[model samples]
Target chain A: MAKKEWEKRIAFLGPEGTFTELATKELFPNDWTIPFKSIPECIEAVDAGQVDLAVVPVENALEGSVPLTIDYLFHEADLFISAEVLTPIEQNLMVHKNNVEKYEEIESVYSHPHALAQCHKYLYYHFKSVPLSQSSSTAAAAQFVAENPELCVAAIANVAAAEQYDLQIVQKNIHDFHFNHTRFFVLSKRNDRIERDEDKQQIKTTLMIKLPSDRSGALHQVLSVFAWRQINLSKIESRPLKTGLGDYFFIVELLEDENAPLMRGAMEELRTLGCSVKSLGSYYTYHQK
Target chain B: MAKKEWEKRIAFLGPEGTFTELATKELFPNDWTIPFKSIPECIEAVDAGQVDLAVVPVENALEGSVPLTIDYLFHEADLFISAEVLTPIEQNLMVHKNNVEKYEEIESVYSHPHALAQCHKYLYYHFKSVPLSQSSSTAAAAQFVAENPELCVAAIANVAAAEQYDLQIVQKNIHDFHFNHTRFFVLSKRNDRIERDEDKQQIKTTLMIKLPSDRSGALHQVLSVFAWRQINLSKIESRPLKTGLGDYFFIVELLEDENAPLMRGAMEELRTLGCSVKSLGSYYTYHQK
Candidate 1:
């Protein structure tokens, strides 16, 4: 295969047919994408300059944050989040084409643990006694079912997975709750300007902050810095520092741009109080309709 | 078996050999316990009067909060947390006794997803090419390996599981970090006084707060109620209300008792601000030494 000059090389978390692939295609429709085995691998690919950008999931509305992505970005990588893609997660119950008629005889169900968890109610109602197995990813689960047609197994994955693996969608949108969305981050070594439709795009700035060890009510003070400045925080989460129990660094997403003076002043004030603040990125979000 | 006069019928998240069982035994050393398949079942057992109390894991140092326990506590059950137990978590790799010499040839590793994730580095280094499977719990994984001795499989579980399932420990303390602890909550219908050695016991109060929807910086204001009063908060986390994205209710743990004037004042102020505040419990923590 020859490289197309206009198409950029992108990396995503995948074995293909995963939600990350959908997000990657949405962000770079014509580009060549390389699928890595894990979120860290995709990030490392971008950090090592093997790809122009890496698209990886950061948070899901129902399941909450993907700690591995946040922790890696904060502790290891020097990459910047150039853009974000918010896509509604639709988990479908799929099976090999041969077993589509024997859906009631599904001996086991397979998916990534999170996907299995998201469709808990549907699984309980339909396949109450069926063994639920975990695979490395939803795509892997679909691939497994596709390869083993003799086994009466079903997988919960995206519709794209069904198409990729030649599986049948027995049930669609089987996730328990509505308004379920996953936020994916587009990462690059440099904060490159992304070319996208300007309409309906919203800018958000993310910061990782570590409070002073000796101070009491330090988190309250950190929030105070923003509260007094009238800056609204879209999200605030604390992840373990891995040093010990009760030691955490917060990932705060602000509803403003990185260049905003108020945000900069707040970070400065936090630093003055011995809090270590790092800007993750100020990026625009593309919402999937 | 007939119920012993003094033995309390307690329910735990278990199939026998799980961390929850250990916590249950620590809290009620001589009580009779019934194992439930999942966290919700354990809570429901207590709520339905099938058991006197339910012991469930609420948080882990490495994994953060157990959202199922917290969500079920807030959304469904009317139970109150009567006591808390802090236990050190030690993950071990075990295999059937017959495969002690064949450990290197193990084809797959099985455990609860969290356990497998906690030992990420160890698994990557030692069994790089092996497939990892998920069981309902670590105990179930050990039991599976014990039952399927014809297959070379290893399980990541606790020492208790190794003894219960008649397996050999291939590796000890396989978890990546030290000081890994899981906090368990003992739930009962009433706020009963727990009998224990009071030495080294710490009193803590937990509150679940839903901020006014119309206000910006509402979390900061909620924290401000305690900040000016000099009350300290040990932990603050937000779990989804499950209504939609970006809608969350904060779970704040205070380093004060429910009866403390400052704590009560803060709750009152929050209510005045149109915030719905619910006191989950005020309990004493017993640390396993």
Candidate 2:
């Protein structure tokens, strides 16, 4: 197990207790895990062959898409999505246990911006005028609360973060909605390098396509190719082409067989209609264990 | 002049010198300008009849979208787009200027996350590993740099902020792209109170539509209604409905007349096709003066 695990080195955006790390542990429990400071760094590690895969959050429920991850995947990194992991984002108000009853005495709280935004209502009603500080990640916020004995400072992080840092969760499941979750993509140098046996559950293919900006019904035509073939779409969203306002590329996710030949035909048809398509990857989704 | 100005009170997300404030000044040059802390707070002020209009950024070239502002306008705030302001996002690296020659002496820098993101390349190359901190706004970061003169710190803000806080601009226009700009929506409580005169130069109609999730070919049908009408879309993007995964609301912008009867027909058609449509607003785009 040790020898096999040594070869399957996975990199994730982390410092431990992060959602990415938590998701990584669920999917690759026996594999070796390394932590990278940023999403770019994590993907770059995988691209450079320093690690076998990179797991990073692609989108969240309330916060919309994770721009840095999507942008890096699109323009910066030359990696493909090997697999995807969906994790329930449960943020908690964690504090040092020594001052457990000091809710009234708490002066400020810390969290990542998206976490803070997700738990906005809870923070507003409970903390009121309490100043909220931002950290790079939720685990970093938890680490701050753990390292500092400051009773007035608390952190909005996950249950794992509380346990990892030995902090007490003052409030549990503080996110605004119960359905809040984040989707993460596991990245690798090559799409088919991983064995297809274990991940035979279901495949979802993601593609980025540039639609003819000025053409009327361009998006409809792009979708018509799928709709006519009875291909069901799980998700579709557009992002700016970065050249100017109003110009965009569509990112669509299709829950289909990994090697569906229909997708290739669709791409060819789209190109004939002056659309450019790039397949992000074809992979299966993993839920938290 | 003062009497007219006093009657036209405007609220913007601010600690002063934010892009919202700058855009507000550009459009409402003579109007009384007030500052609110959060996006919701600013919009709420407009909804509660506290201000005439609220100026908040809805999207940026690099950031993709400001989900909070868009979501609030969609679900929470009963506001309409009175005007749209486009501002060039010029991020400047500012410092106290006491230690003139000591680049290594700069210990930390502060800015809003988006501001920091806009200047990512510059920060990475120049600051190296210098700690980057987050504040509520770019101007608030400038204020932090101004107040904490003893600390070896810099800030990523705008020229207006640097002047407002009396900080020295160490480097200007640090953002990676030259065409980086944010689109600000002037939110108003009364949807049709503002006259269609000065804003009549151009009209861009924005709408939010909910497509029946389980129905096959639902979105393709929605686009067909507009496509056949020769109604071209300027921008289109999907955001999570936040109820569950795979549930989303499409926000589409069309370049047409403010009172185009074709839109009414399109809305009726969309409703028949099982889509709930809500008009965000119609207004002209504001460019940097």
Question: Judged by TM-score, which candidate is best?
Answer: 1
Model 2 lDDT per residue over A225-286, tens place? 98888787888888877887666788888877536788777778888999888787788777
Question: What is the alpha-carbon interface RMSD for each candidate?
Answer: 1.3, 1.4
Worst 10 residues of 1 chain A by lDDT: A192-201
Using all chains and alpha carbons, the TM-scores for the candidates as numbered come to: 0.90, 0.89
Error of 1 at A90 (Å): 2.9
List where candidate 1 sits over 4 angstroms from the true fold: A92-136, A144-156, A166-176, A193-197, B92-136, B148-156, B167-176, B193-195
How well is each residue in A191-274 modelled by candidate 1, as lDDT tens digits? 764757663466788899999994778999999999888888888888777766677889898888778898888888999999
lDDT of 2 by residue, B8-62 (tens): 8999989888988999988888788898989999989998998888899898887
For model 1 chain B, the run of ten residues with the poorest summed lDDT: B192-201
Indicate the residue-level lDDT of A154 in model 2. 94
Q: What number of backbone clashes does candidate 1 have, counting pairs of residues 3 or more apart or in separate chains?
A: 0
In order, what are the TM-scores of chain A for the candidates? 0.94, 0.90
